[model samples]
Target: MPHVSLHTPIGDVTVFEHDGAIVALDWGWVEDQAQTALLDRARQQLDAYFDGALRTFDLPLAPVGTPYRRAVWDALCTIPYGETRTYIDIARIAGGSPRSVGQANGRNPIPLIIPCHRVVATGHLGGYSGGEGLPTKRWLLALEQPEGALL
Candidate 1:
């Protein structure tokens, strides 16, 4: 596996590539660092994303999950930027309960790239990973949200 860590507005983010495609993204810097062309591309895309310049990611992703979990993650990618969907909404698409959808969302290996941050409770901001928890979720949502829209 080859990985690289870069500083972003949310803090340090590390991206990992395995067998030539992006496989995971994490919240902090990691030592024993390595990089590949694919990792480099992922980092560039992430940087552009943080700058509000890239709306969609073009890198290949290979997040590990069960079939149902993969479906949940796939549905997450369907969520457009600057918008959000409820766990129930995704459950409807992925064929499960909101709790199940939430579980899979939490397990997403490639968070921002998979756009797991776009899912929320029916009328509330939902949980998130990374160091800051709900505040981190809020920040990601705020980043995608238009200035006039309430976060």
Candidate 2:
């Protein structure tokens, strides 16, 4: 597995690749294993995204999951950065039930890159696996919202 780690607004991110396509994005300082040019480029793109200079990702992705989970993650990739959607909304879009959508969301291996943090509940911010917990989730949401939009 080729991996690269870089800094982001939320925390350090580690990107993993398999079969020439991105597979996972986790939060942590990367270990000193081997690196590749593709990993470097992925790190650069992630940095640009955290700096608000990029709104879309252009890397090849090969996330491993079931057909339903892949469909959920694919739909998640289509979610614009800084935008929040309810689980029910994603369920409707993914042609699954709300509970199933939540399960997929929880199983998301790529967080910031695939933007799983963008999904929220109807009345509140939902769960997160990243640093600072729910506060981090709220910050990401606020970062995408217009000034003074945070409550």
Candidate 3:
């Protein structure tokens, strides 16, 4: 596995690569760093995303998970940038209950690229397990929010 750490507005994040595909994006820096072309590209994409210059990610992702969880993550990816969907909405698409969808969302290995933050509760912001938790989720949603728009 190869990984690279970079600084971002929210905090320091390390992108992990396994078998040439992005495997995880973890919070904070890791002492053991291995730079690869894919990791460098991932960093560039992440930088563009944080700068609000990129709306979609073009990278190969290989998150390790069960089939149902993969379905949930795939559904999460369908959520467009600057838009949000409810757990129920994902459940409808992924063939699971809202709770199950949320569970899978929490376990997502690749967070920002998978766009898990785009999935919110029906009437409110949901729990987030990445970065600094809810604050990070709020920041990400705000970043995606169009100018003069309220999230």
Sorted by lDDT, highest first, which candidate order results?
Answer: 3, 1, 2
Stretches of candidate 1 exceeding 4 Å from the true structure: none
Which sequence of candidate numbers ranks them by TM-score, best first? 3, 1, 2
What's the lDDT for all of these models? 0.90, 0.80, 0.95
Best-matching candidate per lDDT: 3
Candidate number that wins on lDDT, 1 or 3: 3
- Comparing 1 and 2 by lDDT, which wins? 1
Error of 1 at 68 (Å): 0.7
lDDT of 1 by residue, 1-151 (tens): 7899999888898999999888899999999989788988898899999888888999998899899999999999999999999999999999999999999998999999999999999878888876488888888888887777887
Residue 144, model 3, lDDT? 95
Taking the tens digit of each residue's C-alpha lDDT, what string does model 3 give over 116-148? 999999889989999889999999999999897
Ten contiguous residues minimizing lDDT sum, candidate 3: 142-151
Range of the 10 consecutive residues with the lowest summed lDDT in candidate 2: 142-151
Any idea what lDDT model 3 has? 0.95
RMSD of each: 0.9, 1.6, 0.7
